[model samples]
Target: MADFDKPSSTEEEYFAREDIEKKRKLALQQADQLAAKQREDLRQLHFMKCPKCGMDLHTLKKGHVELDTCFNCKGVWLDAGELEQVLAQGSENNGKVMGAILNLFKRS
Candidate 1:
């Protein structure tokens, strides 16, 4: 049989080793969680296919929102309150016009 513990293994020494091991494990777990969150955020930012033209959809920044637009069909796709955020920015000369255009491409 092989002995794993050191020859001078005191109770305090064992507890100190356990504390270091626990801290290492917690750090690894927190790093993994952070990596997973970053991957999910990157996935959410990926471009999608245009429902109107089947072409690549591009993201356009409207205020704080990222709106998906199809350059091929000149169509825009809004997720939830993205349109409201865009309009609320008080953009001049093209915001209202773009909103009208987006409305024209709405499905049902």
Candidate 2:
């Protein structure tokens, strides 16, 4: 007769596979955490910094929009949808200027 208290070979194999699977899951979770940390670190390093000159950007108010200006390079940057807002508030001369600029990018 076999001893009932002893685990069979199949039971031991099952537990070993379960332990391996648990370790794999933990590794995946740690990788995700590490990736999120890296993205946040990069954002902190580049936030509100100029791309052209690597200088600090200043906010200048124009109508309802806030423009990002780099004093070191004399470069002006517009955020998302700011160009449309500027065109909306601008005069006929400004419209012509924007029209000419837009036309430069149009395909024949």
Candidate 3:
């Protein structure tokens, strides 16, 4: 014979639900925190300064394309589609591409 008993106490069931809810909330909060940290890291990487002229690199929009430029030397640095990369998935590879392009122009 099986004892067809409801939970021994409603309090225990209530506490169980509360514990589950708490864990769910904590997980959501942790995920939000992680996302925010990643965004901050990307922002730091995307916004750079020109070493030669001491001017902060500025992002500008020309028609539909985005460009990065230095205020002093009028040097334009392109991140090889950086705006799309960052906006899509927070990638930092754009900086490397920009550096390579600039170096190529410098060598010639």
- In candidate 2, position 80 carries an lDDT of 95
Pairs clashing within candidate 1: none
lDDT of 2 by residue, 1-100 (tens): 4778889999999999999999999999999999999999999998888999989888877667677877777666889999887787666466665565
Q: Clash pairs of candidate 2?
A: none
Best by TM-score: 2
Give me the runs in candidate 3 sitting further than 4 Å from their true place: 1-7, 49-108
Per-model C-alpha lDDT, please?
A: 0.76, 0.79, 0.67
**Would you estimate the TM-scores of all the predictions?**
0.40, 0.76, 0.42
**Model 2 error, position 61 (Å):** 1.8
TM-score of 2: 0.76
lDDT of 1 by residue, 1-90 (tens): 256554556877988999999999999999999999999887666548787777888887654778788878887788998767767754
Output the better candidate (2/3) by TM-score. 2
Supply the global lDDT for candidate 1: 0.76
